[model samples]
Target: MDNTVEQVNVLCIKWGDKYGSDYVNTLYSMVSRNLSRPFRFICLTDEAGGIRDEVEVKDIPKIGFKDFDEKHPWAKAHGWLKLTCFANPLYDLQGPTLFLDLDIVIVGSLDKFFEPEGDFLVIKEWDKSDATGNTSVFRFEAGAHEDALDYLKQDANKATADVRNEQEYITQFVDRQNKLKYWPEQWCRSFKRHCLRPFPFSFFQQPRIPEGAKVIIFHGKPHPDDALRGRSGKWYRKVLPTGWIAEYWR
Candidate 1:
């Protein structure tokens, strides 16, 4: 690795027991293999006991909501805590920072993500026809979007009531400033939407990775682990064991 090359930041957050240290460790391994650019892998979490030493561990930045609690009913359902990543002066992290959900699998090169021209870029929601974006994969300057967090802090109640989730809130805020942009549709793909076969076909076929996809997001159900073992969360959806996940998910 060339020390003179500019390094970018890759960030992920883990708060609850829904995901374990293995998720963070494997994510770091996968990112290390896929990204050609000199990069720093950072994990913001409440517990860092089992995380690998190579990853720069940091406490999750606080959003300062008066009644904020990760285990609270509303906060548990919505990803409000992710807003903390937008806090101004985010723990000395600077330049283009890419935030990825812990459940995604990186299958292709990541160098091109930084080559795009955009202040804020996210995955356009595959299910919605509106301008809303999926925050599973997004990139922005480390401290560029503090206003979005500030707005949420001003009134947590109204903010939670107005939007369905944190991604929608941030999308609406950035879009209001005319700075919102999306990655190419083929880049970040949803496993449920793009990979799994439909209904009857799913019973016989194993899931396949889409062409030109860099990251495969395991959003709602059938996470990477489940797919690797052929466990479909739904009774109606039959998913066969996918061997390819082992090839890239680490």
Candidate 2:
């Protein structure tokens, strides 16, 4: 390890009303509790009213597409707004940055995330066989990925016409240049895949953290709050009240 102290950054983005202030507040708390290194907690948000002062709030970076409309089907289809993180110069603060989605629950030490060697790091899709990556938890140098933004701006409509989503676009863009990489197989995990008990066992048992998991992602429905209340977002999936969530979710 280097003798010099470095400023690690933990970043989160909140765009629309889909997530409220509580989500950002709790995520900040969870990160503050789990990370051992000295770090700056940042929230890129449109509304920063309810976030804690400890978290540095900045306006969400724009990708220079003034016509970008979130309500448009193509833009909404993928998390297109998240592409703003690729803005070159990215608001003064620049260094190794770990971008986390607001819905994740951190369960283990995060110091290791900054220790990895890579120009970019993300969770490999839990379902795909290809090199596609999930953007839920990704790491990259502050200004390194600006080319992805530039590529999107060249022809906004045409760029997304054949693509699945932003992650696909980013992975393909970086993969072409051989800069794409994934987190260690076990560090980042899915709640339903690794934590939830299956079938009849699910009825009898409560969700438990997987061994060695550092982060748990709640991708679709059954958010952390939903899990705490035992309200499975889907009618088919049963989510019993997970009291353990309260312990870590803050």
Candidate 3:
């Protein structure tokens, strides 16, 4: 490595009322504990009212959509398209950006993600088992993936209309690029893979955070609160390990 001590920037985006400032604060705390470097904790948000003290807060950079015309998820103002800072560089998004969804916890040191690998690095979807990117957490250079935004700009409504999720369109764009890369196999993982059990075995076993997993992502229903309580978000108790949430939240 040219510089063993890498200067990494951690980025997150928040908009509207669906989620509160607590998500950002918790993320900041978790990241602070996990990553050791000249790190920058940036939150691209509409309003910075309740954000933490150390974070560098900035307004959600302009995409020229005027906020009202953003896509469905972003128009919801909380989905995720708003967090795709690498798209246009409007927010002064710079350097190598590690875009993390706020609903996750940083359980281990994140130095592995900084190892140079690809132009754009994302977690390979565990379920799809293909190039499908699990965008819950990913990294890229700021304003680097302009084509991803160009696709939307060319056909704003159509680009995001058919797909039910934002990551779908973004993944499609990345796959076509031929420059997209993925994280080292073990650094990023799905919570279910390392945490919740699928069935009866779950009763006897706890989720096994992989040997070198850097980030455990709670993609769908089970959130940090749910995971913390040792329960999935569903009504019936599955093979979720008890006290996992207490371990992180405490």
Q: Between the candidate structures 1 and 2, which one is better when assessed by TM-score?
A: 1
TM-score per candidate, chains pooled: 0.95, 0.94, 0.85
Candidate 2, after superposition: displacement of residue 100 in Å? 0.5
lDDT of each: 0.88, 0.84, 0.72
lDDT of 3 by residue, 1-250 (tens): 4776657789888777656899898888888887778789999877799888999998665564544344444555325455347557546546777888887766688767777767778877777755677777888887787777666767667877856566666776788778777787788777766666667877777666667776778876677776665667776646455565555543
Q: Write the per-residue lDDT of candidate 2 for residues 1-250, one digit (tens) a residue.
A: 7787688888888877889989999988999888877888888888888888898999877666664433354554467777777778878768989999999888888888998898889999888887789899999998888888777779877776766888877876788889988999889989888888999888878998988899999998889999988888998888889988898888
RMSD (CA, Å), each prediction: 2.1, 1.8, 2.9
| Pairs in clash, predicted candidate 3 | 74-77, 195-207, 228-245
lDDT of candidate 1 over 1-250, digit per residue (tens):
7667678999999987889999999999999999988999999888998999999999987666654434466664567677778877889999999999999999999888888888899999988787789999999999999988777778777765767998988987899899999999999998989999898888888898999999999998899999999998988778899899999999
Best by lDDT: 1
Query: In what order do the candidates fall by lDDT, top score first?
Result: 1, 2, 3
Model 3: weakest 10-residue lDDT segment is: 64-73
lDDT of 1: 0.88
What clash count does candidate 2 reach? Answer: 0
Error of 2 at 155 (Å): 1.5
Clashes of each: 0, 0, 3
> Which candidate number has the best TM-score?
1
Off by over 4 Å in 1: 1-4, 69-73
After TM-score superposition, the amount by which residue 65's alpha carbon in candidate 2 deviates from its true location, in angstroms, is 1.2
